[model samples]
Target chain A: MNFNSAAFLVFLPLVVCLYWLLPFRARKYALLMASWFFYMYWNPLLILLLLASTGIDYLCGLGMDRFDGNPGKRKLLLCVSVCMNLGILFFFKYWDFFGECVSGLMAFCGIPYRVPSLNLILPVGISFYTFQTMSYSIDVYRRKCTPEKDFVYFALFVSYFPQLVAGPIERPGDLLPQLKKEHRWRSEDLKAGVRLLLCGFFRKCVVADTCGIYVNRVFDRLLQANALAVAGAGALFCIQMYCDFAGYSEIAAGSARLMGVRLTRNFDRPYLSQSYGEFFRRWHISLNRWFTQYLYIPLGGSRRGLLIRLRNTVIVFALCGLWHGARWTYVLWGLYAAFFVCLESVLEKPAGKITERLNIPLNNPLVIFTRRLYMFLIFIPAALLFRAGSVQEVGQIIQSLLAADFSLTNALGSLGMTSFSIVSLTLTLCAMARIYDFGLYDLPDNGNRTEEAGRQVSGVLMVLVIALCWLALLATEDAAGFAYFQF
Target chain B: MQEWVVLRHPELVLLYGLALLLCLMEKKWKASRGWLFYASCACAAAASAMLILQGADLREAAAYLTVFLLLMPGVRA
Candidate 1:
């Protein structure tokens, strides 16, 4: 069930209450069942896949632990778990795209071959849970973390409802230990959880959905849209996506926090980063770290020669894009980001010298503002690459942009919003989002009594505002699923 | 559309009005915020009663769920 869906709204509180009320020893079992039930509520049969992944990884971890002295055997065990999980991910998620590519190549060669598609419904959370379980196996093989002996705890870690579908992608070391502990009721955790839930719902239903209304319309009739409209639509898509996925992450984290389990932070004000390299570091932090650890560093990250580092960067990013979807658009999007990020890495020293000669402090507000706007400008084309239907659609957007029909009225009319409403609503959403995001990084200091009280009161006020807007959005717009769920 | 949006969910509109009115009262009655909260809560309860009296249909029930899940946490805070 989606976090914003009606079913999940009812499901979350009931699970939370049942979790707290259950006896200590039985809580993990109850939570495991609840997590499975949560996944099964989407599609009952697919729960088998989840169980298989969990069971294989659990056995593999145990086997690796048993053969700790035999490095070859441990490696073999890790490979079994990785191959099993990746095989499941591939069959379900990537089979159709891969088949189509092969068929196309054969057709182009003077031979006729067709790889029949299974036309399967890609199971939700396969990508997320696969990586999570593989991490457990890899860490075990690396001797970084012990294999979890408790099947129930390990199982729950794989299929935990909150982050199962869309994730902060918790590691075994971070989440498994918490599963073993007792989580009693705490008012503070509940309040914080509610705050996060409110903020998340606000981001999803209000800001993101509002943007979606406009973005979807423009994309649906791409031919009718001029350059300005497409640009506006692209910017809105970026906002819609960030708020949508980050909102899901916060809600997931908040749901776990209600049970006194904290998931890792995902987005960290990525739009405010001063450089494209910094932006990648801040955005989808868990995924980036995963690639860095498992892929980038393994290929001799920065330790190798410059050419190797660039090659590794490109390969990692290309896979990253493919991870988002099995589409050309997603691959281009990943390549687009890698291009800018690599440029920044190569130009950092030169840019530093220019900044030094310009005699401006890096912390200067105007300089920061310019940097943020530059990054956003860099982001717009990447967003187009991400949301476009095909390479031709992206080309059309760029061609129209070059045509110079940059009329504001055409843009607003195409999206069906007046200047006033969009601006006011955008400002309101951004201000509130900034307030909450700032709190995520730097909470109010407890030592300052009055400031802390003010922070609490402001939080209450923000939640109330978020609730009102969230309700209104539901009353008006069509509620869409979280954008990341497709992956 | 009007009936779907407004006629079926008058209580939601009314309760939201009460919530915003209470927020405005917080500024005017700083020393009596607690009393204002309790009083606003009574109005909200009465608004909910009005909704129940209107009977339960699927669409209206959906509206109620939104208020309960999305809006109530704010009211509680």
Candidate 2:
């Protein structure tokens, strides 16, 4: 169920209450059952895939531990785990895309081979949980972490409800240990969790959803809109995506916090990053760290020559994009990011010198402003690919943006938006800028008060604002599914 | 089509403009935190109202502004 939905509103509290009420020893089992129920809400059949993966990884972890001294046996266990995790991910996520591509090529060659498509419904959060489970086996094999003896805790670690869907992909080391601890309920933790949930709600329901209306409309009619509209849509898509995904992460982390479990923070103030390298570091930190530790480092990382390091970076990002979806657009998006990262690496020293010579204080208002603008510009094209229905649609949108019809009135008139839209658009921008300015680096410290009094005030205000927004959303009757659910 | 034009909605524009004005004023005035928060809420509500009324193009612009606002702090730092 969607975190924004009324069903989830009821569901979350019920689970949280029951979880706390349960004895410490049974909490993990309680969570595992709740997580399965949560996943089942999407598709009952999908739970089997989860159970299968859980069973495989749990066995693999045990095997790795058992054969710890036998190098050959440990390697075999690792291979089995990799193959099983990747095999499942490939079958569920990429099989259709690969099948279509192969069939299309066969058709072009006049061959009559037609592979029957499975038309499988991708189990919700398969990509996320698979990685979580894989990390457990790999870590155990590498002697980095011990396998959990309790099957239930391991299962819950793989299927924790908060980061289960669209993740700040949790690692076994970070999350597994937390599951073993007795979860104590603290009022401060609950308050902090509630604040985070409300913050996420505002970001998703108010900011992201509202933007989606415009982005979807403009993108849907790409051929008709002018360059301004196309550009506006492209830029808007980036914003919508960040708010939507990050909003979800905030809520997830917040929800977990309410239970006294801390999920890794998914995003820093990513847009504020001066370099593409910095952006990746700040944005989707959990995923980046995961790929770096599990994939990049294993693939020789930067320990090798410069060229190999660059190649590894590209490979990781390309795969990262593919992990997002089966589509080529995601691959292209990955390549687009990889290109910037490689460029940043290549120009790192020179760029540093330039910044020094220009004496651009990193925190100076102008420097910060330019950095944000640059980030927005870089993301526009990447996000265009993300928003497009197909690769061809991306070209059409780009072509529309490059065309010569620059009249503001014609562009705005064609959109046929009401006066209220303009006002909302303007005010939202202003408020967002003010908030961003206040809390970019330290999101939790937006109110700029460390004093208990200030903390209480900010916390209370945030809660009240969120409550009112939730009430408003409920009243509006048009509450929509979160954008990330489709992924 | 003429009736749909948002330029005709003076009251909506005024409410929106007032909300923006209050937000800016809140920053400068250093009033009670509650007052500042209420003003911000009023601005957010007014903006949402404006968004609901406007066409997709204007909504897109609004979204851009909202995103910029959201990220501006991060970008600035």
Candidate 3:
């Protein structure tokens, strides 16, 4: 079930309460049971897949440790673990897509050989948990961490309910220790968690879902939609996508925090970044971390010359795109990101030289704002590509975007944004801007100033915001699932 | 002698329970009691804010005060 559903709403609190109520040793079993139930809630049979993967990795980790002296055996176990995880992921997620591609190629050569399209249902969070399990095995193989002796803790690590589905994609070094620790209730943790829960729910239920309605409407019928509508929807989808995924991350971190367990930081207000390089650094921080550590570094990363670095960047991003889904659109989306990121890298020196020659201070507010706007504007096209059903739909969206309608009335009308939506979106967008860009309402930045009053007023404000947002969400009939859940 | 708005928020009983717990834990923890005192005060303020928004009267305010005054034990702790 998604974080948006009522079942999860009930399940999370019960798990948290149960987590704290049980004795330390038994908490793992309860959490494991809850996590399995949470996963199995989606597809009962898929839990076996999760368990089987977990078991393989668990054994692989132990094998790596046992055969530490023998390089061959250790390498063999590592290969087994990585291959097993990637094999299952490939079969479920990409088998049909690849099959179609291969058959088309065969037809082009006048060959009658056909690859059967296995229409397999991708198990929910298979992509996420597999990566997590693989990380565990790889980390153990590298001797960065020891193998988890207890199967229960390892299983809980693999399927921790809060992050079992959508994740910050916890690593063994970070999350496993906390899972094994004894934690009592702390008012601070409770307060912090509740605060995260409030903001997360508000972001997801209100901002993302509300924007999602208009975004989906416009994109679903890109043929009929005007330029203003397609472009506006593209921009809205950017906001919707960020809020949806970031909101999930927040709720994941928050729920985990309730049990006095801290999850890794996933998002860092990516929207406000001044450059593509910085935007990516902040966005999906965990996934990027995984790619950087495992893939990029292994491929010589930026340790080599500029050409190789750029090649590595393309490969990582192309795979990164594929990792999102089996779609060619996603691959293009990844290259789209890689292109801008590479451009920024290549132009970093030249841009600075130009700015210096022109006496343009890069730190100027106007300059910063322009950069932020540029990054966001660049993202809109990529957002279109990411959501499109095919490459052709992307071309349609781009065509519509080019046939621009410059009228304010047409722009507003095309979006069909009601006053309520306009008001709610404006308020939330302003909130995001203030929180991420300006840090006006930020607690961490103005710790001393806000310590007394911010937390106090937040109680009253948060309750109102949460109540209103949830009420609005419940009223909206087209409440969509978290956008990242599909991956 | 005074009124508290917390008791009028019967719908916010969880908030009341949390407020009581925060009050009880005020001095027992290693961190400064001010940490928890502010939490209790926030809870108190939220209850009042919610009650006022709900259009509470003076009698309801008085009942809230009776329930809130029970928090006086936290003064020493």
Q: Give the lDDT of residue A399 in candidate 3.
A: 82
Model 1: DockQ score: 0.08
For model 1, the TM-score of its B chain against the native B chain is 0.48
Off by over 4 Å in 2: A353-365, A413-416, A433-479, B1-77
| Per-residue lDDT over A6-108 for candidate 2, one digit per residue giving the tens place of the 0 to 100 score | 7788989998999899998778888888888988998888889889999999988888888878999989989998899999999988998999999999999
Cα error of candidate 2 at position A68, Å = 1.3
TM-score of each: 0.86, 0.83, 0.83
**TM-score for candidate 1, residues paired by index:** 0.86
DockQ of structure 2 = 0.13
- Interface RMSD per candidate: 9.9, 8.6, 13.7
Candidate number achieving the greatest DockQ relative to the actual structure? 2
DockQ of each: 0.08, 0.13, 0.03
Residue A176, candidate 3: how far off, in angstroms? 0.8
| Worst ten in a row by lDDT for model 1 chain A | A437-446
TM-score of chain A, every prediction, order shown? 0.94, 0.91, 0.94
Candidate 1, lDDT over the whole model: 0.77
lDDT of 3 by residue, A185-278 (tens): 8887887787677667767875677678788788766777888788788899899889889888888888988998888888887878999889
